[model samples]
Target chain A: MTYSIIARCPHTGRFGVGTTTFSLACGRRNESLRPNVGISKSQAFYLRRIDPFVLNLLAQGYTPAHIARLLEEDDPDFEYRQFGIIDRENNVFAYTGPRIGQWAGQRVGPYYAAYGNGLAGPETVEGIVAGFMSDPDAPLEERLLRGIEGGRDAGGQRFKGQRRPERSAWLRVVDRLDWPRIDLRVDMHDRTVAELRRIFEEFKRCDAYYQECSRDPRNAKPEEVVMSELSAA
Target chain B: MTFSVIARCPRSGRFGIGSASYTMAIGAHCDGAVRPNVGVTVTQSAPLLRNNRLALNLLAQGFTPQQALRVLAENDAHYDYRQIAIVDREGAAVAHTGTHVRQACGQRVGGGFVAVGSMLANDKVLDALVAGFESQSRADLEDRLLNALEAGRDAGGLKGSKGPLPERSVALLVWGKHDYSDIDLRVDLQDGAIAALRRMYVDYKPTAEYYEERARHPRNAIPAMEFADMLKNKQKAMS
Candidate 1:
């Protein structure tokens, strides 16, 4: 099962998606982000095509709702698929198939959408939505992570009648660069939410290095930086 | 990003693979380098593209699936993290799932098929795929292969960490006696990749048959319009 959040930071016009699944390579499979277009998450019987289709539609100036409608009309097995798309404008659109597993639902806010299936309960998705909506002051990446953590705290995924944290998780944030500003994953870990938090911490720590390298590769000196230094050096 | 099954038809000596992944074009990524009359191999789960080339090379050199896997495992230090399935030219199938893979990771070698998967929701995914293939002895190879994928999905093939997420991408690669695939169709990116694959196969069958007819009996091959009409007639007849 899975829970994911797709968000667009209004201040930066950046797109980001964070997802965790019981399966491996959640980073590779579930999340799809087009640098300037938007973010799409294909979960609950994920299909590789949904992300690309949604992203392309977003790039073509289709609203998230329009893209979702197109996918719904095209997919015969639409009831089994769950998807969420956030356009560059932060317009959120989401769908949960009728046949999806129990406790499946999605919550869409102004600039974000949080959803999950096979979750511990409705509270799981509720927590994720609340988390994302709660921290407008925080960075998009941080808010995305917090949303995942909130879901985890409320019960991330349930299997065999037991609640368990995600086994693999992924976070991707794209800015002006062709490459991702932050792309982190916990491929296989027992505590996916916690590991994602740590990875984000590391990503923030390395932000200065990335910035320095962007300006001049020679300006990035590893030893001169401190791990505790959170801001740009 | 993907789940795939590769097999050989013992009765017809045909080789085929069906796969689904998140990538837009999984065809090139999961080629498995299938050669007619040789063997087919699929390497996934932290896939090393080099391994696919290596396995194909070994198969072309007449190496047994077991032997090739042994050599591959020995040569790559990171083999423990990879999942590979091989079906030799002789229809001997074998699979290797590295220890580092996610839970419910393993492979099942059946009469004429080898199914392997990693990061799956459960081991039942492989079981359902094999069952689908075996249950349809009278069906065409393509139908059986698609059925197997459907079975895998029905068994909750692959899932996200928090819930059962369906497979994102799907591909079906099949070859008859020819070197090129008779049915090489991919629904590379779609919300219903498997469903799209089935529809594509139906729509492309006449085209595939057109090519086959051209290759085998060029003088008797029908015109494009005629072939399209014939397909429409066939669809009407079936309906």
Candidate 2:
């Protein structure tokens, strides 16, 4: 019922997660991020605590693979959960428990992991990887968006003949700052991926402006003024 | 950058606001306070968050929507940059769209509802919104509000350099007899925000009663997961 990509952007040192699900508030529940550290996503039969715990382990200098082993060793309901982790070093690890429904699996790449449970097929995960790898030089936000869009295009979560709408989607990216560079969510939408794309386009226009505002409020132009300038240009 | 509808439902005595904006976090900045059994207010364009609370406070003090708008207009320094709409408990509606707001900005006052927009593609957006709401007079308040938002979008929402601008955020809020909102779905920083809001409303509608029951009588309420499974099975059977 969920698909996701957790990645580290080598170019900008940003950690990001892109995810979609046939559930509500996937953005709020599935992923956790720590700037200058790592990112983790715990889905499938999501336990809200797993993401924070994984981040804690990363903070304690544990590798993603080591944390995965610990989870398998300790968690009683390990078979029902799925996890994807990416560290600041760009090391990636992913796990899909056996009890997660059919069409579930994971793909670990150089700096990212694409994974899903109750998907249409393996193509969904493959598409996510291909999209991420399609443009290595692109900004992390764009690549994350493309990855989820790829998953959507390749037929996202499904159970047999019943295709589930991607009801919720989120894109979160954090830099060195305490706040996220981008935290966009479509909590519930029949076409979550497309809606995400639309907002991304709009947000991109002001993305830099907001960063400027945060850094130098005295010198920053008003949002409306900046928007009008863009429109005129 | 924004368009909204504030309305009171005569059938259920609920108050709701549906709004979309070409800005991030419209739910937090544009949507006003919705006090159950009191009134609802939305302040857009160059919105000041404090105005929402102040309007609600005035409404709670038995001030009419029009009177509340006048007070807000007088106290606000950037009055010309604001667009506000209010719907009170008695079904009276009032709105103010300042002259300094962008082109195609206006407000429409109708029976128990006020529709307003700024930086819109055209003035027809408000007309379509009102028409959509009026067409669904017999439906639930949420349905009517959502329909109006969709209609506004169809009529060309915010103005853009090329054409109609895509909405980045949207929210649907409704306050019933309870102190808390009955439905408060938001799609913050997303395009096709209105559509997303509608989808949320659809998904949440069936669960609303369950949530209320759990809140009021937790011991008698079934486990949420079990209830969800039951609903899923019922949906499967129906399909």
Which candidate tops DockQ? 2
Q: What DockQ does every candidate get?
A: 0.02, 0.09
CAPRI quality of model 1:
incorrect
For model 2, residues B66-171, the per-residue Cα lDDT tens digits are 8999999899777777788888889988888877777788999987889999878888998998988888799988889889999999998888545567887887
* Predicted model with the maximum TM-score: 2
Q: How accurate locally is residue A130 in candidate 1, as Cα lDDT from 0 to 100?
A: 76
What's the DockQ of model 1? Answer: 0.02
Give the per-residue Cα lDDT of candidate 2 at B222: 62
Q: Over the stretch A1-233, how does candidate 2's per-residue lDDT look in tens digits?
A: 68999889988889999999876756643238888889988776655557778888999999999999998898766776788988899888888888665679999888889999878899999988888888989999899989989988888877756677887788888888554667777777678899888877877787677555433344555466677797688
Q: Tens digits of per-residue lDDT for model 1 on A51-160?
A: 76677778888898877788878776677778888877778888988876556888888888888887888899988977777778888888898888888887778754
Instruction: Single out the weakest 10-residue window by summed lDDT for candidate 1 chain A.
Output: A219-228
* CA shift of B4, model 2, Å: 14
Those runs of model 2 whose alpha carbons end farther than 4 Å from true positions after fitting are A212-233, B1-22, B26-185, B189-202, B205-239
User: Among the candidates, what TM-score does chain A have in each?
Assistant: 0.90, 0.93
Displacement of residue A190 (Cα, Å) in model 2 is 2.5
